[model samples]
Target: MALLTYTPEIAEARDKGHPIVALESTIITHGMPWPQNRDMARQVEADIRAAGAIPATIAVMDGEILIGLSAGQLDRLAQTQDALKLSRADLAIALATGRTGATTVAATMICAQLAGIEVFATGGIGGVHRGAELSFDISADLQELAQTRVTVVAAGAKAILDLPKTLEVLETLGVPVIAYGQDALPAFWSRDSGLKAPLRMDAPAQIAASHRMRARLGLPGGQLVANPIPAADELPSAMLSPLIETALSEAAAQGISAKGVTPFLLRRIFELTDGASLAANIALVRNNARLAAEIARALA
Candidate 1:
């Protein structure tokens, strides 16, 4: 039996050799409220189309890995209240059980690779949690990047994580972290992470070339393109830092751990920022979709 299925649009694109950008479904299922999540998914897909690439929003449904989602499928997934959040460790379980699930960054990359897609876009990639030294609760997304071959475009690692530690881990895993058009890594909602990026690329073609070159050199992992959120849309790191600390404190106090921690912190930050965080998240995701489209085109 075929393990992967494609939407009509993606199937046509694949037949025609068109550029395609992979999108994670967790942003629709777990990142936002229902109608807004559906709306945002539509806008991001549109953004990819506008940039001349097809969008393949990957998910698992009815025991198959969906390479792309139709409007109805996206809507249904967005409204699902108990969708499993599948990562590398359990993506197969979700498929085997005939479950509805949303793909995390790791799972999305895996699906994209399986579908022969080369680029993925998201608001941000997960990273080392703040207390990972003790909890050892690093996100599987980092390890996925260390092995997966799909180039990821994002604002950067989620700012709520320990950015320095995340960078160290990426380095240790031999993952190339390239800041797009900047020397400093972006911090999700913020433009500057206050740490120097090991590599900087000024154009999508450059990124695509580096990606191809890495494969030629027999490198195991994909390159991370740390695309910054627009200055006008950024929350400013100074303002976000204190709010992040407070959210982390609240999560710890409430005994939130593991998968619960990120969503809890993001919701709290949204509340503390009076919705600015969500707005920034939407902006960054759209921005990444556009850039990923460009990279996909370059690769094609």
Candidate 2:
């Protein structure tokens, strides 16, 4: 019922049967600093539009879901320091309590499905965290992809996660994880994770048709189109390993875990790479948006 009160520009696009892509808002509030966060948000939307689709950046604000945010709201959210990062479990609570929050990958998928946006573009999917056996920290995004009827276009799982375990869970859930063009699954910021992709599709048409077929079969979930980062922008998994190790050590030493873990690691990597990670982040997100647009267009 609360989902019904949500309204934003993308709602009009949905009603009109236009191509629309769902975008997550955590990148604005938790991924980076204010000005850059707002800038990146705008650029991702621009990328989606340039690729011939409307972008719906999802968030919860003042007891309502915002399917797409205006520039001013985006700016304010990016600058607000204490905004909650919400996922499926907490999304309803945030909405019922009239709390403003940024939607994470999991929350975004749920909202996108409710809004009737069949395609979502994001930088990467969260997965089984490092040390999962002990920490038991798993991302809800994996389960979200299993039942939310919205195709998500992302580079791949973040490299800091246990990629092997992530793939195993995705497989167990009956989620379709299809690589875009390569035989290997991409590691966010890296073109190849050294693991062969379970499935691969080269064209947007094929991916869209598969989505349609799934619906025809009464399937409950969506597809994970694992688009690789542009070759020119890839950081190479080998090169990122040492840097990631250093960042992970820093995170552990600082007692950072759970949600705090990702942002901490990213910030450390940003400083470690002298901004290369951020640049790669921007590039891959835009690339995913473009690919998601193509899929949306194909769906149309």
Candidate 3:
């Protein structure tokens, strides 16, 4: 049905076998406020270009999965209040209904692989949420990583999640979690999670080579690159832990759950931090985009 549509830039890049980094669109539609969301999306795309790769910001709209968004499309998406935050489960339904939707980490990896793009960058991936034992509120992103063949680069699982459980689940699923240039895993918005990484790679080439090796071994899934946020931009984990606890308590009391949990917590934390959380979020996303572009280039 010609469901995959590409903008001219991405189409050209694909034709020429150039590196392309796939970006998820929820960051545009749900991650930030309008003008700021648009601005962040543009800056991240620019960072990818500056790093010598094309950026493919993926979303589903008008019965098609767009591999890349043009400036106008990006602007429209940034302001789309009703867009679905799609994951592996609902992506096809959104497309089938001709509904505009923003891609999350899982959906982005799926679309990226379909487009033959190998790398994706996001601020952080969803994971086992805190208190998942009772609620079973784990995110689909981890499962997607265990099946999709697109390497995802991010700071780590969002700090609001149960990081240790997230790492354990990733390990159980055979997803390789590699820390970039560090031994400790990074928490989103922070440079370190204080948890030692299962693996570490000092260079993008090394990561790319591992990706190729996995293919050679007939591996089914992709790699997770835990790229740390730059030191200057990190919100220290110590400073954030108490605030996170407070936010979680509030969410529990207010009965926020399911897909609504993460965003609600993020919003509350944003308030608790007096806007610092969002600023840190923007920085880490840019950092991840730059690294994803490098990994894409290495793979190309």
Candidate 4:
């Protein structure tokens, strides 16, 4: 009956009822350049540990659904090329075949739920792309949040996405989008995306209490905690908006559509911003790790 498996560390944490936060593997295998990616992965895990929780960075390898990775696994993953980016639909196939794969936001949530982890932390979630209307392209993360009962703390949807539409879809799915200590939603690297969040909660205890309430009320899904990047790390909407526009224009010109849009835009944005975007991403992810730890501790 146990279709999925966990690493020893994660299994022990689960047995001990320790506070554990789930991290996606895509950030290591696909998010950044090597060495930096491995370093950032360790740093985020350390941040969670410092905040009194264990980190479970989920991935699939050698026919096992690895709930946490060792240093060697992380280093190898970062250096390995063409790691299959697995999502909800492909998660089982990857595991069954023993293929090495990185977990996206949606797949990570599923793994977290399977591991009995209540919270997840990540840099930014994938969402509605710029041309969703025409291309019908949207990220499965939105629907995943609406069904999985794991609270996710993220900076917000990536700025390259259609922010307003993504928010709309989350609302339609009845997902609670709570901005942490802020009135407006964050736009990944930016402090504010100029759109007001559906709800706001300042304390991790309050967020934890809300998670309990969702269970009490028999809610199907989880909450979206949108934490803004720190002022010093924020790229500001002013800078990001134009860069996003340029990236979208370039994508349009090249006819980059569907699944290719996100990676294409992110690569172009990295070049356009001279790596500032990547830096901000790492900062926000660590920040989310800290908050997610607090929530997990409260849940414990």
Candidate 5:
């Protein structure tokens, strides 16, 4: 039996050569709560459609990699309590065991490439954790970008991470971090991270052209398009920094580590901010989906 299964919509899109954007399932399974997660997933898929592309929200279930999910499947995933958070390390294990799993940024990239889809949209990419110098905890998302061929469009590295270390590691790995229409890298929910981006591209077509050029040159990795959150939707870095620090402190005191750290910090920050963080996250994800759709159209 094949390891991959495509939803009818995605299969049709592939057969017709329609532009398609890949979406990570973690945002639905692990990022938000029940109804809201389902709502956000639907909204993001709609945003891609509105921008002239099809959305392939990737997940794993019943020993198969699902390139896209139906509405019922999305709902079930959003409500499932024990979905494994599959990354590069354990994606195949989850597949072999037929466990339901949400694809993280790294897993999504691998699955997207396997499906021959070259663009993925997500709220943010994971990166070096704040205390990573001691913990040595870097995200596989960074390593995945260093080798995968699917271009990722994200607000930026999740703000709870150490942005400088993340950028340094990406630079060391030779991954192109291109800030879209901006000089500074975006800080997930914030429009600016105060760190200058190494590369910048203002248009979707330009991004697509660069992706093609990389393929022409036989590059091993994909480009990271740091699409800033819309100005109106952003939580200023100044306002968000203190909340992030508080969340980080709480997580450290609680002994949270590994994958648990992100969810804990995000949930804590959302509570500390009175839910503004999740609202901004939803906005940024939709924004990224729109841009990824445009880039996918250009690639097509």
Candidate 6:
């Protein structure tokens, strides 16, 4: 039996050979609460459309991988409770068990490549956690970027992570971390992570050309376009550092580990910042979506 289901919009886009940017669904199901998530999803999709590309928001439902979702489906997904947060390891399990799952960066890239889509957008990619040497708790996203052939656009690795360690791992994996129009890598809610980017590309066309060049050279893995969040929406890293440190400390005290770490940090940060972090998140995601659309068009 076929495992893929393309929403009508995505099917039409595919038929026409139009540029389609893949979006991960975990942002809808796990990133925010209720109506807000739905609204953000809709707005991001609209932003992509306005930028002249199709949006393919990927997820797993009823034993199949959905390349895109209809309006009703997207609404249902945004309201879904207990949806599996699937990555490379568990994506197949969710499909085999006919369970609903929201794809993370790694899983989304896998799905996008399978569907012949070449570019993906997300708020941020998971990476090395703080004190990873002892915990050895690195995210699967790093390994996925090393093997996948899709170009991923994001603000950067979450500010809650060890950005330096994350960059080191990405370098080790041979994943090109290209800062979009900047010299510094972006931290999720912050415009700068206080670290220099390994590569910088100013134009979407240049990024697209690099992606094609990689494939032509028989290189494995994808490119990470670290698109910085807009200045007006960013929370300066100087202000966020203490907040993130406090959240991290709280998580350690509470013994939160693995999958629980990110959500716990985000929630704590939201409370600490009076919901400002969430607003910044929404803005950065929409910004990334717009850029992803441009890159997709360039690739096409």
**Candidate 1 clashing pairs, residues 3+ apart or interchain:** none
- State each candidate's clash count: 0, 0, 0, 0, 0, 0
| Model 5 lDDT per residue over 25-130, tens place | 9988889987999999999999999999999999998778999999888988999999999999999999888899999999999999999999999999999998
In model 5, what are the clashing residue pairs, if there are any? none
Q: Which residue pairs of candidate 2 clash? A: none
For residues 117-202, what per-residue lDDT tens digits would candidate 3 score against the true structure? 99999999999999999999999999999999989999999999999999999999999999999999999988899999999999
The C-alpha stretches of model 1 lying farther than 4 A from their native spots are none
For all predicted structures, in order, the TM-scores are 0.99, 0.97, 0.99, 0.97, 0.99, 0.99
- Give candidate 3's error at residue 168 in angstroms: 0.3
Off by over 4 Å in 4: none
TM-score of 5: 0.99
- In the range 10-46, model 4's lDDT, one tens digit per residue, is 7889899999999998888878887889999999999
* RMSD values, in order shown: 0.7, 1.3, 0.7, 1.3, 0.6, 0.8
The C-alpha lDDT values of all candidates are: 0.93, 0.91, 0.94, 0.90, 0.94, 0.95
Residue-wise C-alpha lDDT for candidate 2, range 1-300, written one tens digit per residue: 546443456767877899999999998888887688899999999999999999888888887898888888888898888889999999999988989999999999998888888999999999999889999999999999999899999999999889999999999999999999999999999999999999999999999999999999999988999999999998988889999999988888989988898888888899999999999999999999999999999999
The sequence of per-residue lDDT tens digits that candidate 1 reaches over residues 182-208 is: 999999999999999999999999999
Which residue pairs in candidate 3 collide? none
Q: CA shift at 220, candidate 3, in angstroms?
A: 0.5
Query: Candidate 2 regions off by >4 Å?
Result: 1-8
